[model samples]
Target: MRGIAIRIHREFQLMDCASALSIEGLVLEMVGAATRRRAQGLSVRPSRWIREVKDFLDEHFKEQINLSTLAKCADRHPAYLSQVFRRCYGSTIGDYVRQLRLDYASKKITHSTESIADIATAAGFYDQSHFAHAFKIHTGVTPAEFRAATRKK
Candidate 1:
């Protein structure tokens, strides 16, 4: 984990658009390893309700989502759903949704010639600026930089 952190730090320092994909991959790898380690210590599996909630989020992450609506769908209290989701996934529902959106936007940015604003809207971002902010936070580069960097590879 420490080595991953160090590598990520080095990548960030470089701020090379081409390495952005590698950085995202490294981050995912680190998160997966951490999640696995956390899960291994647990004695019980995640509940079916939690799994269902996760599935719902996976499918609807690009759409408007809220805890109350998810709570109603799951037949559970919002607080309970939030708590269980965090316990099972080590991340809040909102964080998970944002990650999904970012992942989708990154792929579109890299694979298509669409305008940034268009891709942002398609990815469920309210506007280009918001998408750029989130994209930079998640990928360590702006959409244009990511696109240019990936294309250079």
Candidate 2:
């Protein structure tokens, strides 16, 4: 009976150790999941960040603005800023910049007497051909054709 009691006590101690280990494992898992969720939450931002990015873009669209520069201005990582900008604005940063340039070019095409090449250059396009291709893609007309049409009326 004495031996049997000692064996039972040892068995209970072992079970207690096993239970403690199981609880510790569960606690660690819960902590890990919480950390992951917090990290994911941090990636999301308020609309103000997007507005800040848009304001910066509006100011610098005529210059060569890239993701890194925009991110720096916004105090965000490039990838994170890109993600938030797209989510809030429904367009990529590059697309937004391109649209701004095209919009500026269109205004120039209609209101100014500058040549298409010079307008393209002023709008931050690398050259006339590149501008024409991009313009056609966006506006469904070449820059000259669009210019002539706008000038007609």
TM-score for each model: 0.76, 0.68
Error of 1 at 125 (Å): 1.4
TM-score of 2: 0.68
In candidate 2 the C-alpha lDDT for residue 16 amounts to 45
In angstroms, the error of model 2 at 71 is 1.0
Candidate 1 runs further than 4 Å off: 1-44
CA lDDT, candidate 1, residue 129 = 95
Candidate 2 Cα misplacement greater than 4 A, ranges: 1-46
| Residue-wise C-alpha lDDT for candidate 2, range 42-110, written one tens digit per residue | 335557867877997888898988788778878999999998876655467888888888878877987
Candidate 1 structure lDDT: 0.80
Q: For this target, which candidate reaches the highest TM-score against the unseen true structure?
A: 1
